[model samples]
Target: MKHTMLAVLLAVVMAPGLALAHSEARPGAPADGETLSAPPEVVRLNFGGPMRITVLKLVGPAGEVPLARTDGMQPVTTLEARPEGELGAGAYEIEWRGMGADGHIMEGTVDFQIEP
Candidate 1:
């Protein structure tokens, strides 16, 4: 019976790739040496599990850039983004915090540059 329980536990632990869960930014964003043609309108993230973004903020050079205010609050899943201004052509970083449906908080950042 112990061997059978061990087999079940091992399978549960090895299923999904946790390392690939929290993504940083949307595609086409500038990397370390990459140049972007246009500015991104909003910061986006792709999460592996269903989640609610408890906190999503775009931090600019100064301090914190305000997200375009929304009419109503809604539960978020999959890719999360703020309703806000066009990410102007410049250096920017996206800061985000999301909670998995299972209640774990997932967070990360992605940096990109926009060519003037």
Candidate 2:
């Protein structure tokens, strides 16, 4: 009975960490709902854990913008990208998918606007 109680206590203590194992993006550049005076040259994504970007995209009013690029497997907690072309004042959505060290796929989006 003592052993069982100890096991339950241990499980309860570790549950939160397990639940948070999945990587999640922290506050990123041009944070969601943020309005920028000038377009950001580079967008920075900060994750909770080391991650390898699998898919990244920037969608604007015009259409999909080819802004983000990665050479190869780069396991990093932060990923930075410089857009390919000039961005005009408008709303943009930054979408991303990444793989964490735990081998789980995590994805999310950040939306912001540029006001000139």
Candidate 3:
């Protein structure tokens, strides 16, 4: 009984940390696996807590697409960036890496397609 109680107490203490460690940013505009008739002017991400985005890249058929970040390099709940110019119809992926509120590095990609 004592061992079980200790285990339960340990779990209760570690649950929040575990949750925070797993917390990651969710796709906002131009969601993952989204298909659109036209190119999106801006890219966005919504985070559960504060995150400092280190890298944000837009890759298209031609290769790396340039983007103008609106959020700069800072901790934020929502991050936004605009493509340097109008994107051509093709398959695109937005890759991002950031430091979470818990100080862990998290990275993800959002793939989208623009119909020709």
What's the TM-score of every candidate structure? 0.59, 0.82, 0.85
lDDT of 1: 0.58
Total backbone clashes of candidate 3, pairs 3 or more residues apart or in separate chains: 0
Per-residue lDDT of candidate 2, residues 1-116 (tens digit): 99999999999999998878877789999898899999898988898888999898999887888775553658888888889877898999999998988899989899999996
lDDT of 1 by residue, 1-116 (tens): 99999999887886665545543333423333345687665455555556566666666555567775341234354453463555566767766666665566777666666777
User: TM-score: which is higher, 1 or 3?
Assistant: 3
- Residue-pair clashes per prediction, in order, are 1, 0, 0
How does model 3 score by TM-score? 0.85
Model 2: residues with Cα > 4 Å off, grouped in runs: 1-14, 68-71
* Ranking 2 against 3 by lDDT, winner: 3
Estimate the lDDT of model 2. 0.88
lDDT of 1 at 91: 67
Relative to the true structure, candidate 2 reaches a TM of 0.82
Residue-level lDDT for 73 in candidate 3: 91
Per-model C-alpha lDDT, please? 0.58, 0.88, 0.89
The Cα error of candidate 1 at residue 15, in Å, is: 6.9
Q: After superposition, how far is residue 69 of candidate 3 from its true place, in Å?
A: 0.7
Instruction: Determine which window of 10 residues in candidate 3 has minimal summed lDDT.
Output: 18-27
